[model samples]
Target chain A: GQQVMQIPQYQHVQEGEDFTTYCNSSTTLSNIQWYKQRPGGHPVFLIQLVKSGEVKKQKRLTFQFGEAKKNSSLHITATQTTDVGTYFCAAHGGTSYGKLTFGQGTILTVHP
Target chain B: EPEVTQTPSHQVTQMGQEVILRCVPISNHLYFYWYRQILGQKVEFLVSFYNNEISEKSEIFDDQFSVERPDGSNFTLKIRSTKLEDSAMYFCASSAAVLAKNIQYFGAGTRLSVL
Candidate 1:
């Protein structure tokens, strides 16, 4: 079985603060993806990391894939109330036709 | 942007009753998938359908669960018998391809409550 483990299950920060969440997979992954689920909303795809040691940025968000492709992290800068949501990391292995194993998620709560 | 649409935002049934969750993926997308998430838990993969057949499934997708494309525009998940443990949010997702880098668009989800 494949497992994606995410840390800091819950995080609360005031506006203008920074936050980061990390994910580790028990087995090597071919690629990893980041998604955000707003309160009572579905998960929305944010970005995907494939190449080893790759890093991608989306506005105030930065995503990094470990060299081994077994871990990754998502960092949010200067959090805002709009950033309140659960961030999840999903992984795809070498096999399987793009089936994803998702992490429990890091729930972010920002206070104004 | 196009989105995946799932019917019946919520479903409540008895422990041994049969239930079906329906999904209509983006018209142009070729890959369809089903996932489940218990309250405050990770989203778990149940099955992946492509070219009208299942390409992958997790251990959680046992004999009790089945999937079908049904027609040109719909993908469905049928639970032969429900259980208290089966109560969760079921999401339908679609992707353009099986590649690692493609994005998967998810539906709002159908919250199942088995009593």
Candidate 2:
């Protein structure tokens, strides 16, 4: 069985502060996708990382996939109140399509 | 952007009763899947459907649970004799294809509470 683990299950930060969440997998993944779910809302797709050592950015957020393809990270710079939500990392294993194994997720709370 | 839509955002049913959750996946998508999340827990994969058949399913998707693509536009998940443990939010997702390169789009999800 494959397992994806995320660090800092929960985080509380003030506006203008930086936050990061790490995800590690027991098995190598073909691709990793990031999603954000607001309180009492459904999960929304954010970005996906495919190549090893790949880095992608979306404005204030940066995502990185480790060289080993077994880990990934999401960093938010100067977090805003709108950034408050649970960030989830889901991994798709080699040859496993349309199926995703999700981590426990990191809940980010930003205070103004 | 096209999005998946789920019916009955919230459902409450009595034990031993059968319940059906419906979803309309994005048009032009060929793959569909179902996942569940219990309160305060991680999202768990339940089953994946393609070509009118199940491609993969987790241990959680047992005989008690079944899925069907009744038509070209609708997908349904039926639970026979619901139990209290069945209380959770069920999400319907669809992707353009069952490939590692494609991304899945998820629906708002249906919250089911079995008493």
Highest-TM-score candidate: 2
Per-residue error for A54 in candidate 2, Å, reads 0.3
Q: Candidate 1, residues B1-115: lDDT per residue as tens digits?
A: 7999999999999999999999999999999999999998888999999999999999999999999998999999999999899999999999998887778899999999999
Distance from true position, residue A73, model 1, in Å? 0.7
Best by DockQ: 1
Docking class of 2: high
The window of 10 residues in a row where model 1 chain B has the poorest summed lDDT is B95-104
Taking the tens digit of each residue's C-alpha lDDT, what string does model 1 give over A1-112? 7889999999999999999999998788899999999988899999999899999999999999999988999999999999999999999866778898889999999999
Candidate 1 has what TM-score?
Answer: 0.97
Q: Roughly what TM-score does model 2 have, to 2 decimal places?
A: 0.99
Interface RMSD of each: 0.9, 1.0
Cα lDDT computed for each candidate against the true fold: 0.94, 0.94
> iRMS of candidate 2, one decimal?
1.0
